[model samples]
Target chain A: MSSKISNALRWIGFTSLEPLLKLIRGEEPKKNGLLVFKKLLVPILSVFIFLGVCNAGAKYLYNIERERKIENTRSVQGEEAAQQMADCIDSGDISCKPNSLPSPADVWSGAKTLVEDHKMITADKKEFKEKTAAINKKRKKQGKSPIEYTGRPSFVDQIITSLKTVFAGFLLAALIAIPAGIVLGLSETLRSGLNWVIQIFKPVSPVVWLLLVSMVIKTILANADMDKSFVISFISVGLCSMWATLVNTSMGVSSVDKDYLNVSKVLRLGVLSNVFKVVLPASVPLIFTGLRITLSVAWMVLIAIELLAQSPGLGSFVWEEFQNGSSDSNAKIIVAMFVIGGIGFLLDRIMMFVQKMVSFDSKA
Target chain B: MESVIEKKTMLECKDIKKAYPTPKGDFVVLEDFQLQVKEEEFISIIGHSGCGKSTLLTMVAGLNDITAGDILLDGTAIAGAGPDRAVVFQSPSLFPWMTALDNVLLGVKQVFPHATKKQREDICKYYLNKVGLGDAFHKKANDLSQGMKQRVGIARAFALKPKVLLLDEPFGMLDSMTRVELQDVLIDVWSKEKITAIMVTHDVDEAIFLSDRVIMMTGGPYAKVGDIAHIGLERPRERHAVLEHPDFYKYRQHLLTFLDH
Candidate 1:
């Protein structure tokens, strides 16, 4: 008993200590401080600080610009606009009093009044306009363009809307591609026949497909809103990358061990349960790998289509920035590129994590 | 007498003939192969490599369509492979995706469809424990050693409580030590469960040790049952003693001579 216990202890100690001992005996940890600063820490910290300063500066400039623009913009007193609109509606100055919620009729009547009589501004508007003219004079001397286009949505709104559209597009692509791929993969007749068609279209650029689909939808399906070009582009991306998933699933299913089929027979696992229990589970690793590849490709291809199709998404936002052709746009493009790449990496990691959870070989 | 008659005879193959189409012509693997298995009777078929031993087993398991003749269970012709018959192949044929317990549960649920989830779990646990794999129940089938995988296969077959258990060289792939250990465990389970078993093997001693009857097959295109010798070795035969038994060598010598042709 004592000998057995000693043997157990020796084995445990040897395994635990061997790696530490190897590390301790490793080549000298010398002269690394200077090398580390040059090779590692300096570059990392430099980029970090540079981005930090740039982002803060951009936010600060944007806020100042917004405040200046809002001040210059003309508007009735909130109290006065509300009172006149309420009185006009309540006292039957118009056909019907607009609701407290400010119906379209109320906004239109107010807009009409403002346009018809533009001399209603108080002294505060005059002072604001004088200050704006002074700033404009100072900017002309310094060689800067005058701020243009009041009433545009803020930069924050544009960024938020772009993010929302990208997410929605990703989800829509997954929903369409996965089931289609699974069905296509399981049937040999479908795989062979459809593969030819897929091969033909797969090489065609998603941008080309998006344009084709958009034109088709516009011509043939004139009933739906043409503004749903984003959905069209997303569907094109899904279709374009679906072949990878279909091929992988078919290959995975085809490669299942012959013994499993025989075992299924002996155990009397009927057709449907055999599919779920044996065929599906055995093919999961390959299928999920295919899904990961498909998702990543779809994500990238959809973004490209969105940009080319003039759709509402991060791709479109980035394209707009590039079209601006400004000095700041270069930095914004770099940021957006990183954002796109980071989201792709995050999505791949999520798929890999799910694969690990569902696969028979979870250690992978 | 009561146990012998009342106990089930799970499988009976009458003049089972199977042939394969070849480039040159047709090649018959099994011709007039017949077998009768009583409940819990461990029967083994031993023959040369191409003697159609496996072909016979497949027909008995209803895996292959018999070219001629019939396979019956309780005097009924088998429609196809059914849960009433469970097979364990030469290599552990457990689905690689399933854990050991899940593999057993697969068979249990199919055989006993009306069984509750809890009941199926218990049945899986009981059989896995019977095969001495109680602790490794959750390990994936591929991760197991050859012996452990076969153990799972055995547990899966037994868990279903099939009327007949068909094992095609279940221990043929294992090292000798694991082979004997598993053989002991299998016989013990067979004694308790009394499910008729038909095993096809190349090992002479395995046949002598496990089987009530060892059916020898002649070789190729005209392969048929060469001999059906009763091992008739006493109950719960000892491993080392059976190896030394004079009659054991006689049986082994007879099989060696029969398969040599």
Candidate 2:
């Protein structure tokens, strides 16, 4: 049982936990204890130290800004005016722009409020559903359809929207890039012919892609009542991020071992079988590396694309909060920043899991 | 007295030449390389490095394109790589993702498409067991040691049931102890199957232990067959007995002298 657990942990890349599990099974406790300390304890301690530094830094900056505001008011008005300004700064007034740099505590409170807001939105949705059902029953008798609920999206809703858009973009990228990469890798002539095009388009900025996609989509879908911004944002993300997958896949396919190819030939395998059996399996490691990079690029560019397209996502949430400029708006935006960063880390871990599953390289 | 029956030739290489085009000019690796083997005969090619022994073997396997002349298997001119000619490379080129059984099954299924899935699987398992890898059927190529990987490679080739097996120094990467062990395994399988075999090797003792005839190639810029020594050693030859034989040293001296020049 312990061995099975150890194997599972090793496969999932939690190799450090294996020693601890072994120690629990009464196998060299002292050695495993040292490993546990080095791997787990050290990282936890480092994180606490970092948080301590950030807390101290935030407090120091807040005090400095508060003092500067008081001094400015005193110089502009009289001593009486300065005291009122100091009181307002102490009370966390929104008028002071310098106070917008929220402390860690403020961001924490902002996160709590967002959670509460999500719960309230859920309650509202339930109530709306019940009300709609009653109204629909009455409308059915009158031969009328029920009205749709178009409420403001909660923070969680925006996050879900962002995830959906990014996935759509990544799917689009994979559908187009992989086949194209395979063809390019197989034929040197085709690769050379298309090299200039790939080179030119690869480095194009996400903002540029968004603008181009928006222009094209707007004209094409002018008559259709579709979600224009959603389509534009995802398409832009796909265009901006696909180059990594394409380049890496081509390189992977081109560098498959010659001996494996010979094996395929000797087996008298058809072209399709040769590719599936020999080319694809041999190049899986490199192709996964490419996919991981492509996913990360898609995530990074998603915010800019969403902001430019004004799509309903975490990116737009951040942008909207910034424009609103309310007292809690800064804290909310900071909350979104942390959320984005956390999601990005999660996305990378997911990709790493998938890459490990597919790759034959044990070290991966 | 035993009835005399003429053995038909299984493989023939007639004035084969292999050359690669370099920027300077055409670099000739092998010229007029020739050999013939009777049915079910084990032939080993021994030479120093750069003698184009491997190139010649690959040419027979239909992996490398012949610049001139032709190689025939059972009176038919062999063209591209086919299921009839299976090769075991020096590096044990098993697909890393596949388990030992799957690696063997891949070739078996490809060659014997009409066979039932159970039959194909049985063929793979049988050959893998023959190579002393019965327990490692589920072990991926990467998980296996170098010797084990080569064993899987041998199993894969044998499972295909090719008319002629070409080995390009299949045990070259292994240590001396493992190489000797695998050579014994190869001899056991070859004698049991009685398949026509052509092996390239740098090891003289290995060639002598495994082959009925050893062909020595001269050093290159255009290497050719220098000598062919027929081993008159008895079948099922034990390693200790072969070492003790007076004829063993004579054949070793003959091959060593050819390789030295």
Number of the top-ranking candidate, with DockQ as the measure:
2
What's model 2's TM-score? 0.93
- Which lDDT tens digits does candidate 2 get at residues A78-102? 7999999888777766676466377
Q: Write the per-residue lDDT of candidate 2 for residues B47-86, one digit (tens) a residue.
A: 8899899989888899889999999999999989987988
Full-model lDDT, candidate 2: 0.88
Cα lDDT tens digits, model 1, A267-361, are: 77777887888888887888888878877887778668778877666677678867875434444555556567877887787788788778886
**Cα RMSDs of all predictions?**
17.2, 2.5
Give TM-scores of the second chain, every candidate. 0.93, 0.97
Report model 1's interface C-alpha RMSD after superposition on the true interface residues: 1.4
Candidate 1 clash pair list: none
- lDDT winner: 2
Report the error of model 1 at residue B231, Å. Answer: 0.7
